[model samples]
Target: MVVFKKFNLDKQSIEVPGTRVQGATGHYRHASYVNGLVEHIAEAPHIKTLYDLFQNSVTKYGDREFLGHRPYNTVAQTYSGYTWQTYAQINQRVNAFGSGLMHLNEVILQNPQLNRWSLGIWALGRPEWYISEMSCNFFNLVSVALYDTLGPDAVEYIVGHAEIPVIVCSGNHVSTLLQNASQMPGLRAIISMDSLQDTVPVPGATSPAKILRAWGEEKGIKVFDFDEIENFGAEFPRKHLPPLEDEVASLCYTSGTTGQPKGAMLTHKNFVATVATNREGLSIYLPLAHIYGRVVDTNATFSGCKIGYFRGDVALLMEDIQELRPTFFPTVPRLLNRIYAKIVASTIEAPGLVGALSRHAVATKLANLEAGKGVHHPLWDRLLFNKIKMALGGRVEVLLTGSAPIAKEVLNFMRIAFCCVVTEGYGATEGMATATVTLSDEYIPGHVGCPRAGCEIKLVDVPEMNYLVTDKPYPRGEIHIRGATVFKGYFKDEKNTRDTVDSEGWLASGDIGFVDNRGCFTIIDRKKNIFKLAQGEYIAPEKIENILMARCNLIQQIYVDGNSLESTLVTVVVPEPETFLPFANAITGSQVGLGDNVGLAKLCRNPQVNAAFLKELDKAGQAGGLRGFEFVKRMHLTTDAFTVENGMMTPTFKVRRPQVSAHFREQVQAMYADIHASTPAAKL
Candidate 1:
């Protein structure tokens, strides 16, 4: 076993080869697309400023789709929105709002107490963009986006943090904000884009439009409709530009990765560069609301591909896909799995007894895949895969998954079922849009693939920083990225900004990963979660955790620990309620949600479930995949999954290690307690 004197990593052997060439080949010409991309970048104004990119987009694809939205759940009932040519008009309306704000500034001059400029947005997707763009362009105001899913406390926290002066939300998002609107002292006017006449009968129900009118009358503030100003811009030619690249466009709060969400001041340049790098095809099932979706929208527009927007329940994903027939899909693993599950469920639901036969047929196809017979699904395709395809709008050429790790089984099933590739991409809000698995090239299931064109992927070794450093062959360490895609820095967070972006401009990804021999990068895990056992062997919990997540559906959350004490590697697992409920053979459903944790844990320890878990663990450990030292020796199931509300998971859904450890501290102690109690008997 390797023992380390320091906590930080000293050396790593993973690296991206300087160039992919024959052993003796000197050089080769750049690919044609590479040349075209470079030319595009060059002929493109230095974009020394972020506004330049917007101007360029407007100039080149003025009539193209910029931002769009539609009704939630309805497929054919979609809408294509105004382009950048109209974006100028949109800006003018925003400027008019700013002009109204300028009027409000005069009123503020009299009051002298009002100094903060904060704006809030609540519209589901497209309207959020309009308000955000307007806020950034007109007043240089900082806008805080509240996640519609959050409760009053989350909304209150953002309002308190940003000290917002103006709250702009659509009908859908305003009601929630109103729950805590009175708490925000600086909140002056609430503007509603959605007609709220019907909702006004309820206690917290009034249109922001009506609210704004009443508030403006009381405070001598002026209000304007977005549509009115939009019309005015078209009638009158208005040409005014905002600040340069250095100017902050939006204050994007972190996904609350830590305890509380810290606002990252993303400049226009940062967002533009991110958007530029993220330009890709838009297929069915992606909304322009997310950062990923926004990037896809820009990329599709530049690439001259039309994007179809769906604003409905993701539950109707099949209907949307079947109706839209999009060629590209950017999604997370969960959605894809659900689609596959739907396929499986649908197959089993059809033809009564024959549903069982159809399922067996699908299984036989997967078995054939393992035997290297190579993707021949005759009966399943006719009976099963076709429905899945039609449900997805039938023309998906590729599916892109990212954000979290995905199970290989899920990836393989989708690829085989859809006859399309499922590739993965990796990046952070800080990295903007640095690395991605390209669609035009080869596909690797687990690896995040190579750096996008023109990206410099280097692993920095900092043994003193608790990060592994290696330069043996393919250098492995912290993934340091320098590319057009990296963000400028965190908003007003000097220490974090300094820590994140090095003097040389390499952005520390915080994620620990390595490039394999093929130049394909695989994320091992988070650096902070990497721990060493008492025996001096370091273990990455994520690798083991990912395996467990894939192989054991019964385990919802797994935390591997053997760092400080070591009789054997141990884990705290949370049971999947749906999977474990059947095993309990419950007494007429005894109050489940919270009350079932103890029962669930005991069931996990039951002979059948324990054997299943151990068998899978051994199979995974011996799969020639994980290092021997990293194998799990002992494990215990927990009651619940780590969640954001409980402070165990980040908003982005990544585990909070410290929080998880704290929550499971007692359980961990008990595991060791039982182990020590049983030690004497084991010795005999």
Candidate 2:
């Protein structure tokens, strides 16, 4: 059996009562790997598996494009366009740098100082950062990913918290890093992917080529091209491989902490299990970067599946897809919905003709699949689905969505547009990804599907002072997870980490969800996000957020706050410029200025807008999907969006609950102040 240093394999095994639960049904047929080893079910290995998979692919699809990109506007780029030997060479070059620093044990020795040897990588989306991560792992350094969107404060937090000695920034982030260099204490060197220009832009370019060019010309510092770095790896010995799975490989900062950043210590094993689960769950190669991709990449590498890296722009992603044609896409719900919206908006114009046709086409396909006529779509795809496919950069077989909830309409539209299966899964950084929808076209809207192999779930009673206090069974308590995919713990914060996982080893997801009799799971909202009214009624904002988002595509994000208050619930709204424009024009019969109106004066004064909001609110209550007490009362909407730079959101685009609450607390309180000032009771 495979084993890591800290996590005991035997202690984490799953043993049932030898009887299946009454409500839990067969979600999946046991795969051959498990069925073949009934008596000798092996322990799941971790990051070593990732290394092994890459080695295998280095032999198998050696000439195939491993990582591809298009840096410039017109041309396409690729790893396979070179050679497998070239990739190996790049690894060697990067490893040399890592090996040179392997003996620098200064980071581990100095607990949590400002310059203790953590790595800071800044790039919105690029492959060089991934290459840098591999090098850091080779040297036993912890890699900290900072968002390019992060303004000075976020940059300061990560740089200050990790005490990052070396920072690898793309063209986009180098200028900012240079300007703010004095703030970070331990930053000895900055590596850029693309070359820096004479006149530095406020936000530097994130392009790899420009950073490298700049680094090469700099004095007293060594710079290597990506391919040249690969060459260096060829000469570096592999003896300096960092400690495996049990060792902390990366520190990811999560929101909800008071001021300082809370680093989540993800071991090689924790990441490995997550990758394994993602592989078994989705059956294809997914890009690596985001947590979903990270898990999928692990699984793919472990299973000898080849991963094709795309330089992080949608145009490049599309180009890579047409060239690489990745069978599996690990994407966020927003991206999928955006793709759907784009396809529908472009292809179907007249409401009575093409629009109705598109709708019917999607509904019919779904209805046919429900009847068990499987895996067949008409040849007229050239006229119908081809254009849609082209819009997605053409060749996608399966698309996996997560990171947020997807609208059912968007899902349906994609199903018809591509004539392919679109599945979804859910989990967090703490647990990797534990559940995924089945690879069938008969998809149920809003369902996250089944748990992965070897995962056991249960509904536990919330503490009387808990987030969810509903008496209903499995009625939206925190979703607890138990599996090999559960993370080890957060680094240095034992109390918070221990509080997250129970004595029985169940990882508290903090998400409120329930499993149906058929074993399918649906997330209702977040337990931590629940707020109570003065009347003692609780409301889950996600449900309301979803309802509003579904009603109007214009609202990108919504935050409802009023749990501890009595009379009214106030909301902060971030409107999508593209989606909101047409609707605004429809109501005004002229071009709307809500575009640059930061005050949202037009939106607040418009009765049509208020009516639409109320319509969604009433539907949510009367649909009986929510408690009557959970209904939202008077609300105020704003057009300003919360972002990482503004300190309202994390790098992953999740709303920083405490930050958001604190930032908008003034606005929320102001509504009540306006109410009291207008009333005669205030005079009394």
Candidate 3:
């Protein structure tokens, strides 16, 4: 509960109360193996593989709920409250599903030329996704996930590259998979995650299911439902084929922000080890394909806890959370920002003493939190904060935010209002999302916590960024990780694999960081993403964007772009309508209450509006400690926010910089051209 007691400040480093980081590399590990690095998965020899983790949980918590989902009612056209299945039940299903896959795809599994069959999983965060994936683990089959945002080209590349023969996915992805089937030479069968019962019947032709079957028939591929496979597996059981620790379990494809998506071959050992290194979740909303989501679910399952699915609709997210009443919430900054805005909006709208009380409460709580006094305030909780807390499931005891840096003020505000442990995580897919995580006692924001147990971390000098391991009070350089949690390597990419991880096994994270004497890390820059301006200034776009986002209320999302060839920088600002509409009207002395799409677009194009935003941004830049060269010279505003569906953002909510540049290529060029033409030379 105290700041000074946060890290024991000793070599032993007992992490919080229950957890212990003994020796140099040990976090969330069993005390029995505290002498050195955790050799076995789950910190136990018995649980050597992921399947073992499942089996042990099933044995220990047989009656405990594992997965929960809200069944949709056809008659009422509404989703019911969460229904759960015990660990024993899911274990049975996993066994049957694995057996069923063998029964259905014997030819593909037993093919002479193929060494091992790889199955593809393409879906949202749902029970079926995990069920099908666990089945693969039961056998020694490799599992490859087709990310939801993957375009046709990326999908085809992954399917063919991984040689994925059978794909188990929801009915929604069938069309896209089939469209890319022609180019995917290894694709053989498609198993539906859900049933075809709900599929509307065709008017003149056969049922939609039949139409899909016929389409598959033409491509020499077979299609079947999830239950069909499970039933068959139950009828014809197959023995479990446990894999070695070194065996690749899943081929996780990157978001392909650049060219082709490269698969990171993550082993069962890698995942199982990471699970020990982080548990508890009530909502499964993030993409299961991402390592962050996968590790969280594994940790939850290992602890024999329940995880309920979101309604597959973002608009109804809070509604589901209120119903589920999850004790913990793991999320990104964007969601928290929206929640903060809503809370602030409501606080401002409250009349008379209520508004004053709300303001007083927030300010007092924030001050108390910063001083390490604690998050609890009986008066504030009952009179002011309980309603806001209920908005994110009243039971939430912990809030974990990651994938991007959250505003420090918002982080503190959430801690005050929700009265929970708010922690930030620092990780990547290559590390299986295992790395530094903020400690509960550490009230200070920005720095990610110490190294996770079993993983040895070091920093090598990045001369290009002028960062050295011997710098000042804190050592700064590129992050290098080597441990049980680190991934095997990129699939069939020896060059890139070699580039990423060196001969000594240190996985070069490409992210520049500074580590304090206490081992807390603050990520400063992306070595690869930073660009140099013509005026000899190095610019980290993400850092500038974060600063601007924190300072400027009008900017919902901003992508700061810098060309190495040019001296100036520019940005594509996606404005939040709540602030932007009103500001635009006031700034221009017109366009008041222009909340519609057309009106917003017009405001974006208006020269006066652009000038006003630039002025505001200039002030914000100076306020946030941005250098003159780093300030955005020109901006193109838009109402369309970057999203997963638009390929502008990854599933984790991080901006795809390359995609952003390509999407607004013309706008960027125009902005730069205007900068060049607005000079006195052009007038002359």
Q: Model 2 — which ten-residue stretch has the worst lDDT?
A: 1-10
> Could you estimate the TM-score for every candidate?
0.62, 0.64, 0.74
Q: Candidate 1 residues 1-684, lDDT tens each?
A: 111111111111123334422211111111212332211233344654444554554566555444444443336665433222244444345555555544444343343533336566755555445545554454455556666434455567777777666666665555444545556656655555654343355687775567755655555333444444334444543344456666766666664423455676666566555544443222233222222354554444333344454554565445545555666777765466556555655565467777887768767866766564545477777776766666556666667776666656666677667755556777766665446453333333566765554345666554644444444454456677766566667755688889888897777777767665555667765556654443334466776788767866566677877542343576777777886566444533434444566666667667566556666677866663555666676667656767899998889999878778787778777776765456432100
Identify the candidate with maximal lDDT. 3
* Candidate structures ordered by TM-score, highest first: 3, 2, 1
What's model 1's TM-score? 0.62
Q: Each prediction's Cα lDDT score?
A: 0.55, 0.56, 0.76
Candidate 1: C-alpha lDDT: 0.55
Candidate 2: stretches off by over 4 Å: 1-53, 56-64, 73-90, 100-117, 196-238, 256-259, 281-292, 303-324, 346-353, 379-383, 439-442, 463-475, 530-684
Off by over 4 Å in 3: 1-6, 9-35, 39-43, 107-115, 198-205, 279-292, 348-351, 530-684
Measured with C-alpha atoms, the lDDT of residue 39 in candidate 1 is: 13
Between which residue pairs do clashes occur in model 3? 26-453, 27-453
Please give, for residues 313-432, the per-residue lDDT of candidate 2 as tens digits: 654454555555555566765456445545655446436778777666656666765565543467536556676676555656667676566667666667666766677667777776
